[model samples]
Target chain A: MVESLVKEYTGKLPVKLLGELKDKLTAQKINKTRAKKIFETTLQEYLDAQVAPGEAVGIIAAESIGEPGTQMTLNTFHFAGVSEMNVTTGLPRIIEVFDGRKNIATPMMDVYLKAPYNKGKDIRKLALLIKQSTLQDIIKEVNTDLMNGKIEVEILSAKLDDHGLAQAQLKKILEKGLKGVNVKIDGSLITLAPSSKESNLNDLYKLKEKLKKIHMSGLKGVTHVLPVKRDEEFVIMTAGSKLKEVLELEFVDETRTVSNDIYEIAENLGIEAARTAVMNEVFKVINAQGLTIDERHIVLVADMMCVTGGIKGITRYGIVSEKASVLARASFETPIKHLISAALTGEEDYLNSVVENVMINQPIPTGTGMPKLSTK
Target chain B: MPKVDPTKHILVPKHSKLSEAEQKKLFDKHNINFNDLPIILASDPAITHLKLVKGDVVKIDRDSPTAGKSEYFRGVQ
Candidate 1:
């Protein structure tokens, strides 16, 4: 009977832990019936730790995250290894997460590589490949010739060799990026002459500046890549995030690689990935400040954001605006707008949720209020 | 067009519409109005594959870490 019980829970419990429990029981000379009873009691205790029905999980989650949020100092810090990259952290980052901002202030990604690439070797080459370089990066100087109505751009030969870029490639990119300009490349010097039709000195100067920012090579949005060693694995940290393009790379580990931008993840992967990103990002900020909040609370917040099949912020214009009850919407920010709009639409407030019920001075439909006393 | 499988998604719970008899039995057993129950939109992906229309009942089977496997019923709105 003991052997049968162990077989029953083989996959459910860790094999080593189960074996230890069985050995402990056998050493005590406990009978089969008693062992089975003990096992059932343990299982019941584990199950009972789960949340009860009608629990106000949303309010609890809000408090759990909000309390820690107040303790965080409002500060934006530069990325450790990369001096040019600055990321918004602490309270502001928390706000950004809850608000579900589409374009994050500092869009960044922690890109993990697959297999041999994740090891220390060949990370520098990979970082250079991922870091987006523009025309300005390889150019020594840009000079505008007002009298000639042309722009002279000096290509740094050393810089070009360092980045492994050819002059022909730059000329091709320039022609494609700027429509009404003739590109002429001679050795290490490139000149751009504006078309006669659009040849105001101001426009030529503007063209020179625009040409300096043209995309030359690497991922489109990525600005900088800093290779950092974490947990004995080499990972590239990019300044500007392009999660879709980054994931498409052959060497990138799709499962482990993630971006701090939540909406980008939703667009690239799906709502599920966005939900996980939200939870992980919140946890990272909270944990960095040496605070411990229950993981379940964070999970609840993520679930609320993703329940509608899309990521929605807990803001007046987002999830709050989409509430079914007019009263509920009015309780949130910009109450006049919501109430006036609802009045115009002749919308009805069913008062099903807590906010609407509380607004009307009624018992909220949760906990003891959930049960109705009917004599029928 | 190939149907997108909703079950393969991690966040989307397995869902199926309750039959008329089963829904009736549930309402009678709980002694509650349909609207009183929790709501899931008609456009929700979990029930989209089921082709559930408005006012239909969907049984959501969620495999929760804490609760093991739990079932929830929602009225499609």
Candidate 2:
């Protein structure tokens, strides 16, 4: 929260910088006591709502406030202390805690739980259920988009159906679309562009064959592994991917696969991006009806994308340096917040600079004050 | 909420299968509503996630792993 940001600006400071800082601090509130309460209550309420028959809902470390300026210790609430509770995203869920006496606030990470079916559910289960339902809804939108677009040929369009026929449809569509137009399929001798000036269909057919082979081999799940070089060791990392492609695969059930265990990053990405088709033409629906999703959940989705695609750090590349991790954790909110703040004051470049710095771990201009302004 | 019917195949309350009518009479004498108590389904996660109505009685196959025996129980009506 911004309200906690305070700098002892001397009288000699420029009025412009001073005004900008004031406006920013005014916009962001220093959520001291409330942040902890919110974290505790949200986690607790999430667990409470999951009461099952003959199961007990236990509350441990439910109300805890981290020391000011200190990062919250990673505490996992588990099922009788067995399975390590993953933080949905690789990153922790954080909230700012203020030191009343020192007037300085710092962020802290929190954890939740998930037990067996007969046992009461925890925060993790609630979050997972929410995330799955949300993605399923998005998939519906994507499917709607795919349906609205006409393939220009009835034969190609006929390839698609209600469920479990994507590959069959795609193969049929490809065959129909490339018929006497440019290619010929005689038994196994596939003649691609025997008459046309191009033979791109040959390559497309080969690729499709490979994908079909992999699919038929029961390779239902594909994981893209990325090892991040941290210190001396490489850490296995996760990312998000588009949900549309996985859903369209017919073999892959979008609902069952949308679990914390899977490294699916986005509701739509890569070849699946076309799922937005016609239904998602209204951008407002993606933003408004797209569910008020938690930033961590989105990051988890992003992690899945990274894992499934074997790509590393799409968030880092697409988002600025200073704000990359935060944006990855919170996804849309952090970026939207900064963009809105910048837009309101015509300081878009300055905000961009801040984001870059944050991404790269550089000292922010607003926080901890300026190094040059020190009085000897 | 769907309408609650007494005729539907509801799970016999635990008290009803307690060996005799005297036990059920005693439980009722104590002013405890056994029918309103939560019941467990044999399904791993159970009826909570199924979006079942309030009065729906889920049939559960109760099993004892150690005893190697199982019996069907109609959860409370």
Candidate 3:
């Protein structure tokens, strides 16, 4: 039966696809006749779902996502019980995802933990470990002595203990991060004196201000971390996103952990992961608004973004400007700029794309326009 | 060339480049030109493992919600 099925699909489909179908049917434990019926139905469904030649898929995708975007709210919402984390959702998020904004309004991460760590582990401790606690977080007071040109920072003993930071580590951090200053650690009180010849009273005040933002502990760029229970598993919801650094943690489930920032994901996990992130992020925002857009549309959009080996937003400056045809780019936005640039570069307008064809009032090379009659 | 780990993601469609004869047959059967088909870049990670040259036709086996599985073709650019 398998041999016969192979013979039937020999030239019709790829070998790997046929093998996969056979495996699927065999796994389902279907009888030979039943398998044949299933295979036929599957093939029919596949053919039916396929876009006909010249279908304006880009337009369809745009409309599919755009129409539902109208129903989306403009307001940002708190991520469930995670009060500290406000996720940018609705129409704004859709725009952000499509635009492929690098620095998102509220970059967050849903960090899943591995094994025992994901269970009823010390979630509070984990949250604290991920939250980026600066010197200001642990400092009781910061003062500058104008006369002596020295800055004094009194560390809160309790805050230091709470963050699990030793005085020695804090001193090291200060010494390494600070420049043109001498760090003098006297118990919980640290003093910064300018070692540079040009330093004065004004520099001391500036140093005091800069000292407050010095990295003390936890992952940098991660502002806050809130551990929430979802489906009986504890997951960390972070305010700021640092996917690469966070994934390096031993307890983190790298496969499942994801960030809202597409570029960061692309940079860390590769373009394929970024593509998935784009789709997931788009779905999340759209789904939150109680609107159902087809996943295929989002998939197409994500594919377009990552197809160039990097994420490029749907904005005019991004994917639009990169369009092959001069007229297509001109039609998008700032037509004169694109036209002039193309002219200067001696770029040829193929007029192959839908927009370029439409611009010149020619029949689009899609659907019936896709085929050209050739007589031999 | 290092093989692309297909098992790394279930969402990404499987990509394979067709031979010259297979590509010609597909274009003829579909009554379409290379430019008429949707495009996937030669740099696409999914097909990068294949080390496909420019103008090669890539066959993608995507798992569809409506259809159990479907085959789509893109001309590599």
Clashing pairs in 1: none
Rank by TM-score (best first): 1, 3, 2
State the TM-score for model 2.
0.20
What would the TM-scores of all predictions be? Answer: 0.77, 0.20, 0.77
- Model 2 segments beyond 4 Å from truth? A1-61, A64-376, B1-77
- CAPRI rating of model 2: incorrect
Q: For model 1, what is the alpha-carbon lDDT of residue A98?
A: 87
lDDT of 1 by residue, A221-328 (tens): 888888999999999999989876777777777657778998776765555556667887988888888888887788787777766657888898778867888888
- What is candidate 3's lDDT per residue for A1-376, written digit by digit as tens? 7658767866665455677787877667767898778667767876786788678888899898888877788999787776767778888888998899988999988998889989958677777778998888888888878878888888888878777788888788898889878999998888889898778777777787888888877888888788888998999989889876777777777667878898886665556567767888888887778899888888888878866667889989788867888888888789999888888999997777788888779998887898888999
C-alpha lDDT of all candidate models, in order = 0.78, 0.29, 0.79
- Clashing pairs in model 3? A54-A366, A54-A367
Q: Rank the candidates by lDDT, best first.
A: 3, 1, 2
lDDT of 2 by residue, A1-376 (tens): 3323223332323334345545654566536465435434544554566434332111111122112104333443332222432222101222101100111111111111112321332322222222212111112111111232211211222212222234444445445544443333343222333234443545444433332232211112322212233344322222223333333333222322221211122122211121111112112122333333222233233322222212222243332232423433334345677656556766534323243556668765442433346577
Chain A TM-score for each candidate, in the given order? Answer: 0.85, 0.20, 0.83
